[model samples]
Target: GGLSNLLFKCALPEHILSVGDEPRQVLLRVYGAILQVSASGAGIPPDWQPPPRPAAPEQLQGSGLCRHLPPGPGLAAAPRLLRPQGVDSLVLESVMFAILAERALGPRLYGVFPQGRLEQYIPSRRLRTEDLRDPDISKEIAVKMSRFHGMVMPFNKEPKWLFGTMEWYLKQILELTFPEEEQLKKFNHLKTYNLQEEMKSLRELLESTPSPVVFCHNDVQEGNILLLAGHEASSSDKLMLIDFEYSSYNYRGFDIGNHFCEWVYNYTHDSWPFFKASAENYPSRQQQLHFIRHYLSEDSGRRGDTTHEEQARIEEEMLTEINRFALASHFFWGLWSILQAKISTIKFGYL
Candidate 1:
């Protein structure tokens, strides 16, 4: 049962007691906490003075979370709320950015406010200068983030499990593949998922290799990367990843592939903003080619165990894998939206 009207008293040198009512009944820990009953049925009187919440981030005026709680339930809703509704999400994201900083002495990610929606306030230090641009720094950050993905820490209230079984996998595959045409089929929700050798191939894949599932940030878009102060000043100003609301447990290759797709699409189809024209910050295409060639070589450490047969098939079939997985992701998201719509009786588009 959620605490109906629980009052938690803060028991620190600086007395702060938290009052929260949630959908679950459980004790929580803050710097120091206390539990009490608020004066029953009492509401704040009009004559009583209470502090006003911040109206704007600028108005927050750089006063840190330690001094004030950030305004709105935006961040609280962020780790789960998805699909845009006007400027609401974008605006909230802007506010969140204002509050977050990095730690120098630890794992290095620090939001200005670590209590309430963020987490317990830990002893945090300032952001350092060397942890951003260096290849070693990038790798370190990527690795740490990978661990979090592997943990697949559910942001929503529910504990998550990757799609239940091979049957589920087969169903999704069948839903995407085409029976009437060898080429990709336009999806029809009412139509049955085409069943063919594709289903067999998928079933074989699931049975043949049982990979350890890890959390993947499926939408690893450019906007999700939070870059610190530029490196020109010799500040490492590393990339801190945000927007994990779209995480799933799946093959890590998809995570890399998703990133690759965005990078490739942006560079090839969009513009030079990604590269500084001289390939300074993020490499130009040629530099990217060199990096992939030299850095991804067998001795370069990018290798994961791939069977010679799988490698051979990969050249023949890797593209198929990408399309298949992407199609699956689409179905997953679409089905997810439909379910959410049905369950909540809320309007949501399916596609």
Candidate 2:
């Protein structure tokens, strides 16, 4: 309870949402999900139960984090999604704008802005480390992908922000924490060489397409997604993707590639029961082929052109990226997690 991070719950018109604060304050980041908290409020919206009002202004000040954001009189968190940003405060701002704006086009987004109701945090319910997996999530994911790509304007900038720029940042995180200079050296070399070649190939790949970029959510972890379903009996469902801190202008393939890799990894890492609950027998290696085929079909230019050598080449490259990403996964996580573990140990000693 004494930890720096604080959680706040905000109320939107369509849904009751939750947000989190950074340790202490300053760059106050809001989580775009539901959480559990207890507080009281007034002037609350009718849709959701309004939180209790703050007894004093000092409590509402909230460690004086972001002066721009509205204060919650008193707020209690409810059970909702909680997705944190990996980057700094500035990046978090951009991410929120890009994502919330894109969602504004559809009613499903549920407004998150200066417009939300009086908010507060109550501790009645606590958000779990993870959420229960949903069955129709994939179909919902596809539609959300389409919606995001459909909304938002393209990014045009000089010097260019390459697809893996975020990965580069993550690599920096890895290097900072990674021990064993040899491991660092090997990864740096591998990344440096692959990045150069990948950038070159990516540039060429983009040359053939004149499509404008959409506000891209570079990371689509399940924690960052919210489902909007009309009813249990109805087939209707839509998803709102949150956490755009790494929002950037790049090839749509980059986003697709990451999400594709995510699914592959998600299915694999899940326990057998977790895997089955998500539906279907676990994806066999051959099922990956069908997934790839489905992915390629999204390329409008490559449609009905299975025989086209150029398209074939692109598909091959995508497959290659997947394999490379898979292999690099351990390298990245190992580096970051290792540093965190080591630092944590040194700071407090073995718990």
Candidate 3:
């Protein structure tokens, strides 16, 4: 049902269920892509084990939740070693963010592994496509997004992660050679677009528009949002955002605008194309303003200090910013879905 990762619900055995402080249940996420190829086989072979996790000195050094938070007592004395040979940089980076997320913002983490980690299994339901348009839910999301944007990460503040990844995806798409006749037929539709030219045009277009850089939860669709058990959508803190696989420092408008585009996508479709996207369902101007207002009001200090004229100017600029960056969101996923069609094992029709 998901791309990139596999999730499993693990329950503690009866004997140990109540013993110690370990969680009774944990969510296991097996990382994607890089974990597929091994020296001995194409995928994870039986009897494989994760390398030992780093400790102490390897503690996360960054912004966001980890900025003021102290290292948990669990991070006690342990041996440290150089980065292992097989582990890629992306996996290591995600592991660091996952650890930081659990400490202050996300669900509590139980264990970390080379491929994935054990996280607290929250009893919740994912928000549906329709839920993203609800005024109350929309306001809450804006507030949370503002909070996320306020923090700075250790990475370069420039929005390189956006165009860099798009460039990589475009390169992969352009290099595909489809040698087999059957493979050529299967992917012939890809010839319709000049992805290289399209990407150049898109990068230039986005570069001309101005937006602030921030640490963004790049994927903020309905499926990634959770409504905790016993809490209704109306509750102030009921919603929680999960999945930081694509999280990075990027343009602020891309984060907000991408979410607006998600209001039309229903990923639960049961047939070909595998999802439904209706452009007519895009948020109205009033709805966008409502969300932007909450986003700006999130920081009480900033909100209280701004004069009415300055607030109006800021709001108008953000409105324009959000609209322009929506194009970036479209260009990004168009390239991303094409690459996913080639590499991903997931059944969804990413193309």
**Local accuracy by lDDT, each model:** 0.34, 0.39, 0.67
**TM-score (all chains, Cα) for each model:** 0.37, 0.45, 0.80
Root-mean-square deviation of Cα positions for candidate 1 versus the true structure, in angstroms: 15.1
lDDT of 3 by residue, 1-351 (tens): 122444555664455435577566666655544344321223222232333322212212221111111212111111111111235545545664565565465677677777667677788877889989889999999988888888756666767878877765565566664444754665666666776777788778778878888889888888777778888646899888776656778999999999999998987788977689899999988999899989999965544778889888888998899988988899888776655555444557765
TM-score of 1: 0.37
lDDT of 2 by residue, 1-351 (tens): 111123433222233233563122222234321122101111112123223332222233322323333322222221221112222333344445644555463222232342132222222221111322233445445555655655544344321344344344344343342354754565555455565455455456456543345555556645445444343423534445544544555545556545544543332224432222232433334544454554455545424455678766766665555544443333333333322332221121111
From the highest lDDT down, the ranking of the candidates is 3, 2, 1
lDDT of 1: 0.34
Query: In model 2, what is the error at residue 30, expressed in angstroms?
Result: 5.0
Record all residue pairs in model 1 with backbone atoms less than 3 Å apart, i.e. clashing: 8-34, 9-34, 10-16, 10-17, 99-112, 129-236, 132-236, 132-238
Report the Cα lDDT for candidate 2: 0.39
Better of 1 and 3 by lDDT: 3
Residue 20 lDDT, candidate 1, scale 0-100: 68
Tell me the lDDT of candidate 3: 0.67
